[model samples]
Target: MALVFKSLRCPHCQQPIDKPLLKQHGLLQAFLKRKPFPCPHCQEQAVLPEKYETLISIGILTAVILAPLLLVWEVSFVDSKLLFGLGAALAIAGLITQKLDKA
Candidate 1:
């Protein structure tokens, strides 16, 4: 399983808002900086869509599931290059799936 990031929306106006891809943007960065973005239409606070936390959990689970397999393969008879390449491929695929999944 991989994390699914749902696109956010303004709660009051129901306008679709772009979810931050990295921690640098959105409320996820509030710990470092709190920038208030007023809803363009309703003049209220904009919020991210629900289920983002679940997505994070899913992504973490995906990593946990993959890590041991990667480690085991590295220690086994599998070629190092093959093992590393496969691990990279799996990680990239997981990230792509999470990014591309529709809300």
Candidate 2:
């Protein structure tokens, strides 16, 4: 579950970071943050979610996220090879999101 990606921080308030900054510069210093990013819709800190219910963390979330794809081809048709593609996509997305939260 370790991540090597980076996230962005606001230049004015050092709050809600973006994707471009991280992808461009790789890493940024926390002390350089100068702005706070408030969500225009909710007026809340644009932060990431780290909280997870134990039940969901223990596989429920996995089922929830992947259920859609499984249902798409739920019929008795495809071979076991398809699972690898789905698993890879899910793993990459999860890794990116995890790194985003920390940045």
Candidate 3:
């Protein structure tokens, strides 16, 4: 069986904590069960980060990369409308992924 260590300690206070997890079981417990993890040393509490909630950073980064590429293609071509399609697609994707990330 694989060992699973779930908690950590505050460096200064030596308080045990629910250290960051990629997909924490902390979510179900904190919200559903009403058992928010408390620090052993201090009253400080926390929640899973927004960036850690889902995998959207990659999509945003991809949009960033493709945005420039589309712009370059548009600049290099005679038919600028081709660039328009590409830019519109990238912008839509970026807006969508950004909303997803916020949620």
Candidate 4:
């Protein structure tokens, strides 16, 4: 969905957060820790909330599980592969743009 790829905004400056920095922070770390990291735009402490992290994790898991099933259901190999790649891209975007909580 379009909403999944929406860019995360900095709470302080309202600028879009950098994707690379969020990727470096990682989905696993964001899910497990509530630690504040500096915002790339405003340099203020920002945290990825547990709820958003959990949702992203679930979305990724769902995509991973269902994409393979598409192949089993007699979908064309190329179509299924494309769907899988799209699902993965969307999942990564969700992780990169996960909403931040004020810290």
Candidate 5:
């Protein structure tokens, strides 16, 4: 529930970068590989922190683990679907709000 809003910034320009720009530049792959990516604003290299990556990984794992457990609990179909949808939304929110650091 600590999924507060955050913005990715360019190290050189110190300007906020959009999520779409990061996706366009393959920054998500660069995060897993611990590689630097060019900032769309200033073209300076930046990298997502290991902590951020780990947090996102954990969020995704939680959603994956919770899916089958929900079914096994025999909750009403509508309730289970609602819970799963909430979980998935949280995972994606965590991903978007995590910040990137200078390379």
Candidate 6:
């Protein structure tokens, strides 16, 4: 199983945010519920686009699939890094597809 990532964007300013940033701000609730998440760039509230919801589901699936592999498989460090990188790339791609919406 491969790792997958989910990306987030600020709808107001259209700025991309990584997982760490979102976690720091406790914005996952907004994303999960399609509620408004504040945009640091524009100081406005924004919500995740409907189209990008699948990305979040995919990210969860990937995590479920890859977590056990990481624990039980004899994967090398480089392989693990590459897997994680792929996950990050998926997340970034999902984020890039996001569009801003005024809430």
* Per-prediction TM-score to the true structure, in the order listed: 0.34, 0.28, 0.24, 0.44, 0.46, 0.44
Residues 14-56, model 3: lDDT tens digits: 5444434312534435522323433334534433333321234
Misplaced by over 4 Å in model 5 are 1-7, 16-32, 70-93
Ranking by lDDT: 5, 4, 6, 1, 2, 3
- CA lDDT, every model vs. true structure: 0.45, 0.40, 0.39, 0.64, 0.66, 0.60
Question: What TM-score does model 4 achieve against the real structure?
Answer: 0.44
lDDT of 5: 0.66
Candidate 2 local distance difference test against the native: 0.40
Model with the higher TM-score, candidate 2 or 4: 4
**Candidate 5 residue-pair clash tally:** 0
Runs of candidate 4 with Cα error greater than 4 angstroms are 1-7, 21-34, 66-97
**Residue 74 local lDDT, model 3:** 64
Pairs in steric clash, model 6? 5-91, 11-100
How far residue 32's Cα lies from its native spot in candidate 5, in Å, is 6.4
Give the count of colliding residue pairs in each prediction.
Answer: 1, 8, 0, 0, 0, 2
For model 1 the TM-score comes to 0.34
Candidate 4 global lDDT: 0.64
**Residue-level lDDT for 2 in candidate 3:** 12
Candidate 2 vs 3: which has more lDDT? 2
Which number leads on TM-score? 5
TM-score computed on alpha carbons, candidate 5: 0.46
lDDT of the structure predicted as candidate 1 = 0.45
Write down the worst ten-residue block by lDDT for model 5. Answer: 1-10
Candidate 5 lDDT over residue span 24-79, tens digit each: 77665664465787887788888766665556666666567666577788766546
TM-score between model 3 and native: 0.24
Write model 4 residue lDDT over 1-103, tens digit each, in one string: 1122456787788877655556665632442356777776567877656655555666576568777788788766457677667777766766776776788
Q: What is the lDDT of residue 97 in candidate 4?
A: 62
**What is the TM-score of candidate 6?**
0.44
